[model samples]
Target chain A: MPVKLYIDAVREALWEEMERDSRVLILGEDVGVRGGVFRVTAGLFERFGEARVIDTPLAESAIVGVAVGASAAGLIPVAEIQFADFILPAVNQIISEAAKLRYRSNNDWHCPLVVRAPYGGGVHGALYHSQCLEALFTHVPGLKVVAPATPHDAKGMLKAAIRDPDPVLFFEHKKLYRSVRGEVPEGDYTVPLGQAQTVREGEDVTVITYGMGVHWALAAADQVAAEGIRVHILDLRSLRPLDEQAVVAAARRTGKVLIVHEDHKFCGFGAELAALICEQALFDLDAPIQRLAGPEVPAMPFCPPLERAYLLNADRVAEAMRRLARF
Target chain B: MMEQARHRRPEAQWRGSGGEVHEFHEVHPGEPPRHRALGLDDAQAVEMYRYMLLARLLDERMWLLNRAGKIPFVVSCQGQEAAQAGAGLALDRQHDYLLPYYRDLCLVLLWGHTPRDELLAAFAKAADPNSGGRQMPCHFSDRKLRIFSGSSPVGTQIPHAVGFALAAKMRGEASVSFVSFGEGTSNQGDFHEALNFAGVHKLPVVFFCENNKYAISVPEHKQLACANVADRAAGYGFEGVTVDGTDALAVYQVVKRAVDKARHGGGPTLVEAKVYRLVPHSSDDDDRSYRPREEVEEARRGDPLVRMRAYLTEVGLWDEAAEVDLRQRIASELDEATAFAEQAPYPPEESLYWYVYGEEETSHAG
Candidate 1:
């Protein structure tokens, strides 16, 4: 299979999942008729029918809540929140009820559902349309949060998420959806959740990142490789049950690390990784872990300079990579 | 006939209508229904007493844990034990389901959750059975007991219960799903949406609101313009009934009827269990900041545990000595739970990656 884009992978995954399981369904605004804002769910309604690919009201709460209800009833509902920023309205359903149902009941019943949203900045999406809120979801227990950077991972992880018997928040980086593509197997396959993918291997310094940050980090690593600094890049596919072991092992190998994330630096998922590495794998490090995050800026801006400054692009990652290599 | 002609279509059927329909269920004019009966025997009564007492003790201990810096937070259901215990006993664990809010510690335990799990969840210990120490205390989940986990947000579970009930109907199963939330949750738009959908679809559900008269600092007066939570049911086109939540027997009888009605395809019912939150909203909250000490003292007068003790005494089912013994036993058990959780290992650094999705080995091994 030739390399495919993330959005195409998502489309193919949904198409394949619906084809494989009659119980799987899609519900969200413009998802059915308008083919979703990003067209990730384009043509789904035509193929799966309206009942399967439902065009829900503009209520995000209802979309998520109804999905919770539908999932509790034994349907595998993949609900799209359109923009990740719009997900706050439905946060209660995802954070409180959908996440805790099985734990509170002591494993009596399980909420087997997936909530999909287009997250992150780039493409000039304003504040509301762009945000890497994986930390918010990861901070919550009883919920599984996954963000894939490649088409193959998207297809594999999404299929696995749909089949899993718990609620999962699947974040598709809006910037990478159409831009990032790779070969995804046509047959049944699943990228295990809570695992990290080593996108590039090196030994001088490790770059730990996820979602869109993976691409930026990879780009930085490639640039740094020209200077003879080997950078080990670990793309965190999942945020909640973060692959700490992979991070620890990589940290141990390089003895230096740079945490890069599109989310603001303060209280970001990168902070969690920093804490874990310090708490358990501190002895293996040669220097303090450096993090080059999007400037602790407010958010995505309408202006090009402001947006560029707010997003953690390849340049920042490259600078951080060089700094860590020196360390 | 003239009155019927003059009256407009009930507002419960649609949004923006003030007729009191909750979420999706409606309350049409009719005789109020009850829950399925729990055939109480001496042994079962004793079990209920133990469960209620243990729940109360656990709530108090958790509150202390929060104060002592052992647990991060606590949401105690002190005065609402009878309602939770009796309603829990009324349901068929195998066929029915419960979607509880954060305050439903007893209901969670009664439905088969262990105290060890609750303690771990409360302490945010890595060994926490609910989410591997991911969620904060009181946020619980399990897949085996047919009980839905709860989030911190109120009123979100209402529609989930409706969906579960709808599934039961679709599956041709004689099952009902009961969702429990506090009185303040009725103010939410989702609450109305869930009730309306339940009533319109005739889904087998019991929407029970533990009317404790407060949403953190806001009292029932500010929470709703309606006279009572049950009164809002009139808008939903189904029978809404208000029961004394402190009275276990009364709550049991009413809930039993509602469950029975649901099981027999009578659709959903809105049952409001009027009660009170004896403790502060949570360990992190201080009731004195907003609630008058006098009001807290007054609310404490009708504690459900005391009422149950009186009821059991009148029926020659309990006495002072029996109460002391039971209290001592429950206290000891809760103490053990706290000690066990404190000593349990924090989630291993590597263990963080476990169980996000069910491990194929575990899912298939079992």
Candidate 2:
């Protein structure tokens, strides 16, 4: 088994897709010559040529709008927005145009597009670059949101999103792009969208999380197992059509549920999962749903101490697990 | 008879006053004969007139529905009929695409969309094809006709249109895309960005601005200091043309030439149709607050529909009796469409999950 990083998996997936289909293209600021600020699209311009791997102007709105038109014209465009925080400028394209094209046209016209960006905190990217806007997109009806936690899932999910017929907002965790590694197959493969992957299985309690939080949930599961309490860790690969069935069944079997994410608690993805549990599996719950998420901090500070306090890590996940065990 | 045949020749003939007749031909330099290549004829003109009138009638019906509280929102496309219907007739509906704004019901109707779809969308009915009753009235969209969905937000569709046109270029198809917006859209940043990309890539897209004098209540004079919206195209390094929007023939001629240029790989063009706003921007807006009664009253003389009716009469293709019959036929067609739409069932609430993606991708557990 080879240890391939999530960033490498992303690059590999893009290369394979571009090679596989002439309709597939890549575009963003600094993505071509500089190989992307984070190297997610590195070496693609050299391999695919300038036409396929376009180095666009520093305008997020243009990047998204161009991709929207290209997709409508029968091209499979994958646009990189550089940072999730900067995606606000093009949020109109995502929420209004890309998300609603198929629904508005009654499936007559489809915008088969993907907007990929590096997101989440850690490595001290400061306030502007380290925010999670998945919940904002997940609330939108026409968008399918994907947040992969590992290298294998990253590559598989990217392939699936590229092949998807509607618009997909693929959120790549900047912290996990290089830190997380696993063995990925040699050929092209795709993990189905909106399907949650069960990373580790246990019986006592269920820890539902995604992206960076998936790693922390697994760590908490290990720490709790040593303390005589078992936990099931579920990583949600896609957010929009959430794996509500898996979430409810896990809560019913384990009798306790802990939802974790790096986003703030207010109107976060965790809140949606909790509501789904309350709506479907309320009687099966042993206690109220607990969420281990980033504190309600307006901005992520550059200092290590403040940043640590603002984000959810393994220690916080362990604390959440202990609380669930007590319940 | 020999003299009559010689006089009918298309070449210029010297007159007794030493002036040339300047026989009617293609106006541009290095251009070939227009009638032989374009194959345009009287039938196309008749179609354009019918579509333009249909658009106007549908817009009038929408306003009535709004006043009666049957529809939540309405954006009328009055007085801009020539620009909308002329451009619609010039493009290939099956191949060419339209990235329209909210006030594009006329354009969409000209591209083969039924009046029932407009009414259903206006009423936000369950069977509303535009947005499944989720979006407001006048936001037109139809996939079969290649009409892109319109949004309430300004200038977003400009870039989308460029991308679609670029895609067509990439596929080696000769299709061109046309995007329509009001003069107010020129102020938005997306408008500049879309134009810049379209110019740089030489994408086959036409950036059309229906300069309807006022953006909501703000007059064009206050919006900018430029001479006309077409003049702005020079900055983007493309050909810009302005035509009298009230004259359907003039708008048709200019847009048809531009559309031909784009399809032939000549690059993008900016066309500004100078028309008057005959109705308030939307049902919610009250133009009386900002626009003077005298201005509105005076602008009525240059109405596109009335001017087109005059043209039809001049061509001997229409008269008062024929106009009455045409209106009755259009009204009857609209009535049939309305009855069909009202009888149609509302969309099932359970289907709120379908079509978010393709059918093969809809099996998400959550």
- Candidate 1 Cα outliers beyond 4 Å, as residue runs: A49-75, A92-109, A202-205, A221-231, A252-256, A275-288, A322-327, B1-94, B100-156, B169-174, B188-193, B196-203, B210-219, B230-366
Q: What docking tier does model 1 reach?
A: acceptable
Q: What DockQ results do all the predictions give, each relative to the true complex?
A: 0.27, 0.54
Model 1 gets an lDDT of 0.79
Candidate 1 Cα deviation (angstroms), residue A118: 1.4
Q: What is the TM-score of chain B in candidate 2?
A: 0.85
lDDT of 2 at A65: 93
> How do the residues A192-235 of candidate 1 rate in per-residue lDDT, one tens digit apiece?
89899898889899888888888888888888889999999899
lDDT of 2 by residue, A1-327 (tens): 567999999999999999999999998888998999999888899998888888887788989999998998789999999999999999888887888777666666788899998999997988998999898899988789999999998999999999988899999999998888899988878998989988888888888899999999888778878898888888888897788888887788787999999998999999999999999999988888998887787869989998887888887798889888898
lDDT against the true structure, each candidate: 0.79, 0.81
